[model samples]
Target: MAERKLLAGHAIRRLRRQLGLSQVAMAEALDMSPSYLNLIERNQRPVSAAVLLRLAEAYDFDPRKLNAAAPGGGADAVRRRLSDPLFADLAIDRHQLEEWLAGAPDGAEAFARAYDRMGGGAAPGAAPDAEAAVRREIERWRNHFPDLDAVAEALADELRMGAGDLYGAMAERLRVKHQLSVRILPAEVMPGLTRRLDLHARQLQLSEMLDPSSRSFALAEQLAQEARGEIDALVRGAALDRLGERMYRRHLTGYFAAALTMPYARFLRACEASGYDVALLERRFGASWEQIAHRLTTLHRVGARGLPFFLLRVDRAGQVSKRLAGASAAPLAEGAGTCPLWNVYEAFARPDELLTQLVALEDGSRWFTMTRCVRRHGMRVGGVAARFAVTLGLTTGAAGPLAAAAGVALEGAAVPIGLGCRACTRPDCPQRSAAPTGRTRVMPERETGASPFGFAAD
Candidate 1:
């Protein structure tokens, strides 16, 4: 159906965007021209079987995704439909369609086509690209010590307070100092009101309709921008980049704001007494699911006493947000830890479900993940109306009592996890969607099998 094709096209386009590739850039990589790439994107040119294989080989894209979603029909019918003589009435040619099919990559052409179908997409509002800013800041910080990451595991156990407490303290400071009004506006009001901070009016409005947890996080994020300068300054040095300087300031201020609400000593005590129950911690700090997740990862600063934990956040469709850790067994710095089998994706379609998994990394680390929905209560609004879930996971060695508190029964021993499929070296994994890098086919038909990739003698 047209609808199914559109959905598939949209997914392909999304992948292209996430990888930060432009149509021209992708065409160049795939050894094709940009104009022909454009036609394929419009779905006017069906992706050739060969290009699909190449995409899987290069990027680890699930090859099944391209062929499985389209309606059942041969490539020839698709070509005829595109080249229908009705187009000779329009002077369009079949050779143009064939050329696009033969030369372009799957995602490049699809992205162009989707754009044309959408009638030209527009940039979202300018509320600041927080993710980019955060990465820049974090990377700058990492560059400074080149060694701050060295003591994560040991320091995680030294910092006695749950990371949540520090974040909480920062949130409180914002509320009292700014007198920023925090309200739960209805879904319709979410657009203009969710993150409106009118400094002149001395008012901060948030959509109340958001789950109580998300409401608190939005407030905390705003407050953090102002409150934690002193804390962040303590770590200041010649290492911070311009953007990192700005974001670190915001992060520290947020920490101060959270500290204002939930002081370190006090929050630390609560975690000890409550046994680090995240749900209980959620109630204790008035924070959202993700806020609590972030707090868990930050438990490594000075004097904290807890096992090292690494945290990763992935959305429904597999876009990753935060990757933080004070742990050795984590690979948070390079790429998102994604597994197609991860139950986190289910949380989007089934909002009420809480899925847990013990994932293995290719390097042999085991991660304990908890996935649930974290939605901004809205259908149509200026702010994003899309509700997504977040998965908070740490290694099994550092999981502590929280797993028991949540009643999560551990599964079989951890499975191997990779930073991302491309950089992974796990051979013979059934879940692999693409060929591992450096793979080359020695035997042609012998390589034919359910698995898209064939064996290559390393």
Candidate 2:
């Protein structure tokens, strides 16, 4: 296969204008001739790897950001909106869509947002579920908020503390700056409440049932809530409705909490050095497995980035509770059941054990996935606990470095899986529970086949 050409002239032009640099000056910064830079900006020349590295060094840019394909994020959003069953009969041209997205990325984004608000239907008042819409918005950005990361970096600098001392520093800041008293109340008194703030008394109450890591995260979230201006700036013009705004704010608080706990620069270096070992990261940062997994998805800094990985949390019933994808690995349908063949659900049988698998999707794309069951509540024996399985998935291409570092072989046969039985087209899958959409089922009259559903081959 031929390598895809990177014609990111528009991105280059935008960056040049943002930096207030003339063509000659930018060319000099990149150590390229003015004419060559002009050709590149006019989409007459494809950006070379050497030029990409030079741009990274000069402007501290992520090479991925400058790729023409990367600008189709808005296009991906549009595609996702159109994938809804409401538009199942619509025949859309892919090339034309890409042309429109490349020509007017902002217009594509606005249209996608409008479609989302309209619930992909003709009626303007047909709004989607607020929480689900918020989730889609978060997924649209790949769950990486540079603004939140920047805010966390600033706070980390202001404190000048290590991860071990983060909790104490945050607590001190809360008391000294916010004049709020922090108290841990017994679970009996604060039933069903993890953290609560009493504004009248300026008291922050935390449940004693929470572990040390949870307590620290609660403090970080409280600090994040105090930064209302930053949060508002991040969510401004997101086209979120009232409920969507509330849910987005909640998600933003969680993002800030993770950022504060694992400061971007330090955590990213540690992540790369440690080969993204979740156990080691959890021990080093004083975070839970879930926290570490969620934090791994946010390593999308411009210049210095860690491996692009996606995180998914699922219950024993095969329901996906949360999902965050770093790239277009696979479409995680909201509120839909996942493949039982996925190790996320299998992890429940072997609780607390790290289970790794290389799975091939219906699209023939392979991914390396690691799953482990996590207890959400207290670890004390004889106490009722809430448990969920978390899976971290990475594309085969992105898994190379980590696979080498972790001594995992990627040459072996990969397990076959699908989005779900409803959308999966794999005819030989014995684990399928339902017939795939738009496929006719052929009931056997004489004998039963090895598979459950016998469908006519396409």
Superposing all C-alpha atoms, what RMSD in Å does each candidate have to the true structure? 19.4, 6.0
Model 2, span 1-458: residue lDDT tens? 02557777777878899899999999999998999998887667888888888989999987655532233244555665554434544546678777766666556656665665564444666647676567666765677878788888788777764334877888888999999878988877886788899999898898888898999999999999666786896577356778889889988999999998899998988887877878888999999999998898878765677887888888777766787766543554331447878777778789968998888876567888888999886434666677899888887767876633266667668888876776677888888777765668888889787677877764
Report the lDDT tens digits of candidate 1 across residue range 389-423: 67666667556566442555444566566655544
* Residue 78 lDDT in candidate 2: 64
Error of 1 at 242 (Å): 4.2
CA lDDT of each candidate? 0.51, 0.75
Question: Which regions of candidate 1 are displaced past 4 Å?
Answer: 1-190, 208-211, 214-242, 378-384, 405-412, 441-443, 447-450
Instruction: Judging by lDDT against the true structure, name the best candidate.
Output: 2
In model 2, pairs of residues that clash are none
Write down the TM-score of every candidate: 0.55, 0.79
True lDDT of residue 315, candidate 1: 69
